[model samples]
Target chain A: MTYVKPLPELTHEDRPFWEAAREHRFILPRCRDCGHIWFPPYSSCQKCLSFDREWIEASGRGTVWGYTIMCQPYVPGYADEMPYNVVLVELEEGPLLYSNLVGVPDEEIRPDIPVEAFFDDVTDDFTLIRFRPRNRTGE
Target chain B: MSKAEFSGRTAIVGIATSDFKALYGTDPERTREDLATHAIRDALDDAGLKKEQVDGLITGGTVHYEPLAYRAGLTDVRFCVDYPSAGRMCPMALMHAAQAVENGLANYVVLFNSLCFRSNQVKFGMGGGWMGTGLLYDSVYGMASPGAQYSLAFTRYQHLYGGTEEQLGAIPVAFRKHAQLNPVAIMQNSMTIEDYLAARYIAQPLRLFDYCLVNDGAVAYVVTSAERARDLKQKPVMIGGTAGRANFREWYVDLDFWADACASMKRDLMDPLGVGTDDIDSVQVYDNFSVSVLWGLEGFGFAPKGQGLEWIQDGRIELGGELPINTSGGMLSEAYLQGWNQHAESVRQLRGQAGPRQIPDCQRILYWGLSALPSASLLYVD
Candidate 1:
């Protein structure tokens, strides 16, 4: 069986973030002036409100800040993936990113668990950034 | 000009709620406008004020004041305002209405909310309707519903605080105990910690029992000057002090910062009332999800930080406990009216009108509108 999930409606500000994920490298906007790093791809820095920003490649390492096992499919596309894990990762650089935690059982997932980013090319046009335990690699 | 002037200047003179359970799985015979009109009429009758006397209109959550005024036969409305996106600002609508009345913008104001989620088949957490830039990150990852959003926060809370599902189970159990006494509560069936633990998980860290009932209902309140309220039909529940604040912009990504956010509102609300946490006899914390109540308990100074689950385990939040919370069963057991039911329960408790579930000699009640981003608190005095 095939599944089609809801896709992100890309805007100019979001395009860079999604484009970066396609290459299997994690990146976020950083303020050149006030030295603040932020997520969700804002043109200006949230702290200093400065447009002097750059997209820096992140370390692809973060700790599990929090997570949940989606017991029910909120969207029809997730019907087969019942009880999947949705995790919030606090990137080493400072921003928290929302993604899924794979390669770990739901009960083993906990806050402060070390994880690394991995990419899933759901389609040719879109790629999703997911995470797994820092120990194991391969899908 | 200052908190001193705002305290006790405006009062809630009348309150009314539509039948909560009756609207479940029912057909859409009443539009949102009709429900709003019905609640307004009921509130007007409760206050013994005619429709012509209502000079101000304020509403939130999909209610337009213009059409509601026309449907309620309110023609002399002087000040009209509508907060269409009032998620956590639900209780602040009363504060805004009070400000209008105090500023002489209007003499009488009706603040109401009407939601028909069941009848309209509105699924709240499906994501996609109003996608702001900030929410795009989570929406794209299948994290659409509010349950999933809040689960992230609560999961982090439990991890940091070291809590068990059995400890969290106490919240629903206690609320259901209170709901059993509330004749109008939608889920009056007795719930125990065992039942809560056994409930199917909607989102891990949050089960079916943790979520609010999606039923159709409307709640309305009439606000007027305190002096004018003395001549009305019911004993007035005075607006003592109201305060609200939003966390720094990282609200969506950082869940731990909510403790400080809640603490900020707590100080802002209590300072104006010239009272401390000890002065509040009862509370009506927003319980859209059970975790919200936990945050409210800690943020509102009812319990020490990171000890809300322990506080509930000690039975301090139950009826006949130290602080009787959600005396009308709250959103968990009561109907979900976007925290409007909490406002009505606050008024009822302050007036000593909450029959069997009434906290003995309730004097001052605190209501917290705890939500994801923006949060508000109200101090009501009898």
Candidate 2:
């Protein structure tokens, strides 16, 4: 089946982040004044309430902060993917990003598992930031 | 922090839950107005107060204000406002109503929540409206409603705090057992921990058994000053104290599992009323998901953090045990009134009206829900 999943509803402020993802680079809004970073793309710094922000590339290296498996297909387009896992990967930059942990089995999934981001160009307009387990030796 | 001066000044003089069908979609014809008016009239009757005496009204969860007041025959309600709907607004409505009455803004206030998820499943249930507005951006990953959020949090909690799915089964089992004594509860069929394990998982680490029922229902509470409660027909359940804080660190997730907010409210609300966890005869927690029960207990100082799973075992949270929780079966087995009925349950426990589920010497009760900004941590006294 074609992709029937709910896509991100992006506003102008949230566009740059996804636009960067389309280029296989993950970016986030950094407050120029306070050096605070955030995810899912907000306009201003949640801390210090500053609008002085610079969009920069993120390392996209993160650890598995937490994960959950969907035993029931609650959303549209997920019926065939029952029991799949959605993970919260806390990037080294300290912002938690929501993505799927690919190339790993359910039992192997646990917190603090090292993972690295890989971009998936889902459609002509959107590229999602997903993750896969990273091995030692920096491979 | 010092004790709030508003402590013990206002009391819940009346409480009633609307008659609900046994299950969702069974009563699709019942309108929201009828449900709200029924509970409001019943609550007013319980306090022996005329509808004209109610000058303040607060509503939650799909309940609009002006039409409801007109249908309920409440005239000249001076203070009318619609609080946000969902589990969190349950106690906030009660606290707001009490503040209005205590501050002399109104002589008597009625707070009601009418959830009609049955008739409007697409709007309330299937559409993901019940989950707060943020965090939908990750829907591509199959991250559905708040259940999945709890699953992720509970998954991390299991890693850090060491709780097992087997031990977590006790929460739903205990609440279902309590439902056997609550005549008004919808899911009164008895369940066991083994049965809990057998149930299908809605989200991993959280089963179908762990979720609250999504049935149609409404609940109302009559609020008045303690001085005015002296002449009421029923024993008034005094509003001893209330405190609240934001539990969010991320957009919508509490990575602490509501520990900080729970502890903050416990110190501010309970201590000021001269009550502790032991002194609290019962607790009514927001059981939108069963894990929240343990989260609330641990954060509110009933059990040490990371030990609630151990503390809740072996009928400890059951009725007549150390601290009976969700005695009206809560939203788990009882109808989901969006935590509104739990407030009524606390009031009933304090008034010694919980029937066979009543706690002995129930002098004090706590109604708490872990929530974002403007949450509620309320205490009631007999």
Candidate 3:
């Protein structure tokens, strides 16, 4: 089997983010002073510059804010995944996160479509957070 | 700043360009060099000067090609600068060149860009490395191409302000119709709102027609003080004012609704240029993607956020509308030389020399660099 490399290694600034994502939790920095969630996991809030922070779990349920169809595969190994959808998903909690939209037809993807979290296990150490169309089944 | 104005200081002394539609057919082909040669010659000829007279040069590249000063043979020039904002870099460089002339640092500055990307380049993945980083973050997650990046902006714009796809398509359709009068445009493919809406989606919310073409061409300009421009060959196109603004990171910021750089440009560029939205007689807002045109209009205060689409469709942005934008068909119709050619066209419009596509008494114009990182300049025929 061809091995798929996980996403780029996390830097010191964003290590908390990747560590939380490994456990299927979407983590963001909650400023102790301003009570705002920071994106890409920052150490301090630009608003208050407060170093005191807390990690919060996101609802992982949000609307499709915007997206791109990669007609050209960005990664050489993922050529077979040509025309996959990359999207900016606005989590219900208030942060805009980037991920691939899966399990749906390309034409059906539109603005404000509700989505829920899905994970990809590329390797033993890596599990990526992607999203798919919200459950349509009544159950 | 007292609202920067280009009124009577620096002028376009020369302009040059090569015929745009060349293709890179093979592996050893050098399309960048081809575009640079065309633009450098046209700009020098327009100014009635030679390569040896150039004291400053600025260029941008794709795929890590040869730099402009070296390839265009502007060697030994005192001021050499390269702007790598891709298509946006062209106008940014011109703004710098104009500043150099106004400051007495350079007598004549040449600004140029050669834009060409072959289909095979994508097929073989030859020059795809330039976008690899974007792929890792933005692209990897779905902001795949320029269309996708702009789509994110458009969506956020609609979320906050309410812009529709049909309204969004109006910007390109207006320019495409305007382009019909020019012979230089590539995608002369007749476009109507129906045609645009019916077109395939390159990225969600951005159809194929809504995107600008990747054509093979080059554009260039020579800037010098107004006093010396009179002695040159062509009518001096005065540089009224110039502004350059860049966002922190397009992917990080919501371009549609939250355009801080664009807002800064309005205060810094328009105030100093001494022209309000109504003062502009004609314009050449970059159309790298149609949404960019909308963002530029809103950013420049020509229209409010999300209302740019309505302004475009209501016949206000057409050739005979309140404002005539992209008279040389802009990047949508004529050539997408990384918006370098937009500057040359501004000079042509100000000179009343844009044959066949000329706007009557077209003076007092505004030229936007690109949408993502807003940069702008105002020029006039004084």
Best by DockQ: 2
TM-score for candidate 3, residues paired by index: 0.83
**Tens-digit lDDT track for model 3 on B1-382?**
2434445678877776555443323334656666677767877877789888888876665523235566666665777776674566655676688778777778888776665565325322121222222124442343444556676666667766776898887788888877777666665678888988988766566777776765566677788888888889999988776677665443433544435666777677677655688888987877877777777777778787667767777777778788888876777777766776777778777888878777788878887755445677777886
Q: Model 2 over residues A25-84: C-alpha lDDT tens digits?
A: 889899999999986567778888898889988887889988888888677887888889
RMSD of each: 2.3, 2.1, 4.3
Model 1, runs deviating above 4 Å: A1-3, A135-139, B128-135, B248-254
Candidate 2 structure quality by residue, lDDT tens digits, B328-354: 888898888877888888888887787
| Every candidate's chain B TM-score | 0.95, 0.94, 0.87
Cα lDDT tens digits, model 1, A1-139, are 3437877777876688888888777788999998999876778888999998888988888899989888887765876788788888989899887789989898899989888888998888778998888953422
Residue B276 of model 1: what lDDT?
Answer: 79
**Local error of candidate 2 at residue B247 (angstroms):** 3.9
- lDDT of candidate 1 over B251-345, digit per residue (tens): 44336536777778777777766677898888886777788778777877778898888888867888898988888888899888888888898
The local lDDT score (0 to 100) that residue B161 gets in candidate 3 is: 76
